[model samples]
Target: MSQMLALAILILVLFIGEAVSIRTKAWIPSIFVSGVLFLLGFWTFFPPEIVTLAGIPPAVAVMLIYLLITNMGTLLSLQELKEQWKTILIAISGILGIVAALFGIGTLLFDFQTVVVAIPPLVGGLVSALIMSEGAAAAGLPTLAVFAIVIYVVQGFAGYPLTSIMLKKEGKNLLEKFRNNELTAKQLPGEQSGTTEKTVREPRMFAKMPEKYNTDFFKFFRLALVGYLAYLTSVLLTPVVGISPFVLCLLFGVIARSIGFLERHPLQKANGFGFAIMGLLLFIFDGLKNATPSMMVEIMYPLIGCIVIGVAGMYIFSLIVGKLLKVSKEMAFAVSLTALYGFPADYIITVEVINSLTKDEQEREVLTSHMLPPMLVAGFITVTIVSVILAGIFVGFL
Candidate 1:
């Protein structure tokens, strides 16, 4: 679709979603609305030109990728990254383990010719996966593109449903805690804040994240350094030593964060997120330009399947994890669901419910604070795993 048309459709969807949200007191989960938008975009704006060098299409795509990357990087402010160190470490382990296990399993089951080559980017994200997939195909794996998109579809949608079931109990407990008073910066009604004077102020001050930062060339340097290191390692290992790039990126991010290198730099945080995302989109779009209609359709099935699995898995598993974390029942639900679907769905659902129940600004901020990081991390992890698995499956060397 044309870029403006695509953006218009997205805005319209958001408007409709918000309108329905007001009416139903939650995000409108009606499948029909999404379907209509899908049709409108597909029929009217299925973009043309295979790698256009001079056109609005190419420029728009480039801008989209740039914005995406910048936003992702900007999210990584030093203090915020520091606060997330422990969880990020855990996420690294899980992401690596998942990518390895899923790749091995897919290879063993299908033993496809050379899908392993595409695995890194799929796990990394579409753009990264696209790079890996293209490299694989150039090396003789024709199905790489299909696999990368398949992974995206799976991780994108599957996370929603699965997290819902998993966090059911956690959600309940979080509600109770909200009713109680321990999980707050300051106590609410019928509670005393004699010692929580400072606690209450922290939430107000830290609730909003600053979006702007000073320009620093070093920040971009660190980001490029990480990317280059990961790229070099992935290229050498995948071709020579037989390793995956997805793991390479995760390792690089971890190392960058661990040594007080990237974390110590204020500007590097944003640069890191932005580059990762933008580079990824550039890669994915490039792949899309090369793909035929047949290839797109071929990948659609897995997209549907994987998304279902991701959503179902999260919903079913979040409750168990949420309980362990001791979050409230509803809050637990919110956490688990948001774990992978961090885009905005969780906020839509939880905020709707919270607003209906109470106008407590403090409560809303607390819930958002506790859940956002985990959700973002979960998205990164899930996307990576899904990418790798698809890569393995796509190459047919399995």
Candidate 2:
């Protein structure tokens, strides 16, 4: 295919997947849909180099990962992070549950190598999957590499409905509380509850600079600098400390944001986040090029085993942690499942459940206020922070 045609085909597939996801209210994830299409396309007529032809080379994807991870740091403020400590503890415990189950039972059903390759993606999302995929490929284990991608592609099917059910139950319970006047819409600390007034805090590092002077190019430049520094620190410390560059990028991104060295949502501010993410997704799909129907079938035993065990682990651990923390089991379990599909899905499912349970704006606000923070925090802690760190460490085992 021509370069333009190849790029168009790739983008078209992503567009269709996104459309389907939105239409389904994220019952079906965009990644799952796009991943299936890519697999089918590669198994049939698509060129193995279609991703490259689409102009998203491996190097470009790697660069985007660094920048995007750094941008993720700007997603939450230090106070926001501190306020979600309970969510963080619960989420991390749930991941540990997955690890325990996988190591304890998964190793028995599958080989140790198989369990090692499976755990990262099971505990996190695309980045963890990418880390495992790349690690498996480097270790000359093509099947394991494909296994990582397959795990990431399908794990959401298990997570979405389960999380939706839990959230719905939690929402209804909250609605009951709202009706009884036991619950009320309340603003988070330092945040205004209603939309009547907006809080606009100036960036500390650039407080004196006018908004117009903080151009897109400047944001990109700052983001790139942070990414570079992260890479450099990883190079110096990884061998000695066993940290991944991706993890460093995330840490440095958070620190940079906290210190006001970078703006909030730097990539989005630069208007480059979407394309950067698309490039990373394309790079992930590139692994599908080598997968065949037979290979997929061969890996099914371990595939099914890992997911079942992993999620079971998440449930048990989440419940334990929730009880100790005095959090409701349903909400805690829902938070734990963020490991399966993070971010937009976690956010989407919460909103969908809240919308389904109540039409009253005040009630909706109360439910959202109660549920959304924990879910978002759980996702950030598990997928954004812990997963990358785990993947970096786990890949070494593989």
List TM-score per model, in order: 0.53, 0.79
| Residues 239-333 of candidate 2: C-alpha lDDT, one tens digit per residue | 78756676667677778887878866778768998788788878877877866778778888888889999999989998999999999999889
Off by over 4 Å in 1: 1-10, 17-36, 43-79, 113-118, 161-172, 186-359, 377-398
State in Å the error of residue 350, model 1. 7.9
- lDDT at position 347, candidate 2: 65
lDDT of 1: 0.44
Off by over 4 Å in 2: 111-113, 125-149, 160-201, 341-398
Over the full model, what C-alpha lDDT does candidate 2 score relative to the true structure? 0.81
Q: On residues 138-215, what C-alpha lDDT tens digit does candidate 1 reach at each position?
A: 766566545654454334234433344333334345556866976753222112336352433211222242324323
lDDT of each: 0.44, 0.81
